[model samples]
Target: MLRNFVILFPAFVSLFWALLFMMRWKRNSRSQNIWAVALLLLSNSMSIAALYWHDYEDYSLIYKLDVLETISTLSFIPVVFLYFERLTGVKKKGQIFRKILLFIPPVLMGGSTVLFYLIVGEERAAEFFKYIVEHDGALSPGFYEYRYVYMCINVYTYSAFLVVQAVLVFIYAGRNILMYRKQLDDFFSNLEGKSMDHHRATLKGLMLFLILVIAIAGSGNLLYVDFGFMVLVFLFLLGGVIFYLCYHVYFISYSADNFIMELKLSDEEALENGYGIMGEDDFGNADTGNMLRAKLLPQLTQVIEEDKVYLQNDLRLDDLARLLHTNRTYISRFIKEEFQCNFSEFINRKRIEYAQELFRESPEMTQEQIAEMSGFTHASSFSRVFKQCAGMTFREFQKGH
Candidate 1:
């Protein structure tokens, strides 16, 4: 029963998540499709672990399952990279080819496995397997003509590929997230829901998963000796990580695309304009800069400070630009130059200042009341930003006052 469960648990978890993603595809096909396919492959690959429990004499079935597992392992990092790309809203031109390139390792590795089995023939393949099993995995290079090729493709090459892919994905995904957060700061004043915190958590989970995978793969001998107990542990970890990511991705209502669409801009245009409205032709003009400095800067200050537009909970850069009858690019630039902060920081500073004023006027006001009145959608956000702007927590500041 334990052995059966050891084989079945990961497969069941993978299948369950795959089905969930499939069901959700209609509502969110772009994100769900890749995840569904990945989990499906994972479900199929779990059968490879069954070999440790019972010596199945079926060489062809074993080879096929091994190939599937190899393909799944090879594709894991790339799938993670794509998932992060989706979450971070890092849409770029010609991504199709780049994504295809990332999967090339899996394709090549799978093909090589198939070719190895065909070339070795069932008799020799079975013989090789029996020898490896009997000898405690001591390789006899002289016994198999293509032993080195098999080892390279199955072990060293794939391990090296996984490490390289993990490093690259880590670097690039992190960079994309940082860039996304910066973009959000420039585009919206209230980043309560748009902060991509979920994505960051998923990324951290993915890194831990990769490290576990690499460690287990490196210590492959333990799986055979421990009767695949480590595989069960690995799968349990995998299920936990998958559950975290799947649950978050499933319920996450934030769509970077929808937010960009709300701004009424295309991805390419948004990228070029830095999520603002000014075209290349209007940038870096001494006259335009001077005019914005003299007129637009004061107007921005007046609208935000005097008119108290920062009290609007959903205030955004585009809304301010529309009100000022100017492009967001100009306003964004002016905010940076005049206040030395991005739009989010400038507006949140104003909101924090307003919160301070309220705190003084009505010291009995609750945190939630002050947050709502000061244009923060959440008390938690208001408190966090208050501490950031005021260098103390609300309670501490109130006590001082």
Candidate 2:
């Protein structure tokens, strides 16, 4: 009964998330597609193993499927990293090189199974299975005879690959996050890495998800515990991913547009710009920077007023630049020099100004309605920015009115 559950639990979780992924996949969401594929790999491998568990008569078939299992697992490690890479907007300059390094592990890990198939053959697979569950594990007396070969496939293969992959994933994810934090700093003097920003919040989720993946993947194969008990742990890992998938689905379905709206790019614009508008380092001045503030500042104000661009929740300098038909650095300087504030404050001030208008014009709008109409992504974000700009909470401001 317990054994049946170990298999059923993960298989069920996998199937559920697979449905969610498929739904999100229909929406053409790249993020969902990545995870959908990963879940499918985990599900298929475990399902195969479970179906054949009692059929030791076809033991070679099981071992071969385990080899396939290892490959399925190998498929997961890099794509998980790639998911973060794609999410965090890592620059593409060195990606080719990074991909090469990323793929080396799966390739190196594959060599283990090939060598296993060669020396041990299907006949020796049963013995290999015994070695895993008993003995000192790889230290069995016969292991020394063909020691170097056996150790290469067992000790030096996926075991080593996993360790290196964990270190690399941690360094890259952390580094990308720190750089993005710096970007938030440069863009808005008031904005902090407070996880209120959807990107930062999602980064936290990504870190959690990756940690769970590493912990489970590393330990699952080790089976250092009883194999039966280890299966439960793997089920727990699947549960963790399902939780992350729920989070991922929320963002993609509900907030992804809010986040993308911050870029103010159409899909075409994103492709054309290569999403390059926001990350420019030289916010100093472009050739067009020579325009007199007296002449250009009013145009900036006009665009914001006429277009009502201030109401976008995740609006960025790049969006403002695109609106003004100028470069982001120029817009960055415009907000600082003309408004004497960062982008967030400049935008929030306008939103508060607009919210104040709605208060009088409609005289019946809820704070939430006002917040939404004014371009806030959430009530909390709206209230926080409103309070910062108004010198009072929304209630206090309402009372004052």
Candidate 3:
């Protein structure tokens, strides 16, 4: 265990730091929480491996470690599903089936353990450990046969799950990219100046890096036939590189300082005007209604003032964050806290509001004209949001107003 501890210490440390970083985001993000839990489980698996390395001579102990490994491996599936759900904005209908799938590996392994105990009994279990210790790293033929079957089952199940997850990830990523590209094309076609160029470059880089990372991870897994732990090490290193890119290149290069400064100014203005003030302490502090209002007002103002930007054909949180010179996490938090809406709803609300104003002021304009002028790519979306928000059909609004 000590020898393997030294070999595995770096991985454990990397995972710990990753978990810490994730915990910060997890407060406001379901996806981050899922990933954090998955990493923690993987860390547990590593610790179990260390224990097994020390007690490899004990067959019973080895079997118990194997059971732990199976459980840890299965835990990854739900995390993957949750990650995809967040990435694609898809909601699970019940999630009961998914939960069952996640539990299957552990249940099977536990059942096997019970069966082993029944066959060998408690005394034999102890005797078996002593016999293996005396035999010097050699196991009985029956044990080898059982272990081989177990390993095969694990490999097949894990590989099948990975394949399913990979397919889902690719599909989700593709849809997001397509939507993002369409929005960029629409916005860039209208806007000019360095800001637009900066946005374009940033989006391109972010999307490219995401695709590259996924490709690398998939390829690394496939090459496990030869690489084994080397591939896993490469993945760990790649994750570190991604963290560096996100912090230094993406966040810093975007100049989030401007956004933070703006937020500070807004806070001061709100306080001086007796509007509201929101404070987040380093320790656990309760959130107040005034503070919530204060934090949300600026974001709402931005949406109203920058309606054109928000009405992009393929708008997303990342694109909005770049435009605001902030991070996606901040944007997501603002939408949830202030508007009680998701990113899509926040953007749609802006579009609908713009359409409402057009319909009110430009009474002579047709529904199609108003929708187009209000930044809606289609009149259908305009009508849908208009009815939902205003509680009246577009024709009714036009007629009544």
**TM-scores, one per candidate:** 0.88, 0.68, 0.41
Tens-place lDDT digits, model 3, residues 1-401: 44454546634653765567575763424544555665666566556544433444556565555556556644654554554344324334655675466556556655665465456665665555344444542344555534444334444444454455445545544554345334333222222221333434433443443454456334522321323366456445544543442332222221223334444665455455543422233112345545544665676577558557755655545555555544444556666666786666666667778888876787899998887776666677678778877888999987778
Off by over 4 Å in 3: 1-6, 9-11, 18-26, 52-62, 92-139, 142-401
Scored by TM-score, the top model is 1
Compared with the true structure, model 1 gives a TM-score of: 0.88
Off by over 4 Å in 1: 91-101, 130-144, 220-231, 265-280
Each candidate: what lDDT? 0.74, 0.63, 0.52
Residue-level lDDT of model 1, residues 1-401, one tens digit each, is 77677566767777888898887687873656776776777677665655644666675566567777788878877887777677667777877877887899899988988898788887777666656655656565656678787778877877777777777778777788788888888988898776366767766766776676677567654334434565567767776776776666666567566666766663344455554455534647877667656777678778877899999988888778777766777777778877899999999999999888998999999999999999999998998899999999998988999
lDDT for model 2, please. Answer: 0.63
Model 1, 210: alpha-carbon shift in Å?
Answer: 1.6
Q: Which one wins by lDDT: 1 or 3?
A: 1
Stronger candidate by lDDT (1 vs 2): 1
- Lowest lDDT sum, 10 consecutive residues, model 2, at 187-196
Clashing pairs for predicted structure model 1, backbone only: none
Lowest-sum lDDT 10-residue window in model 3: 186-195
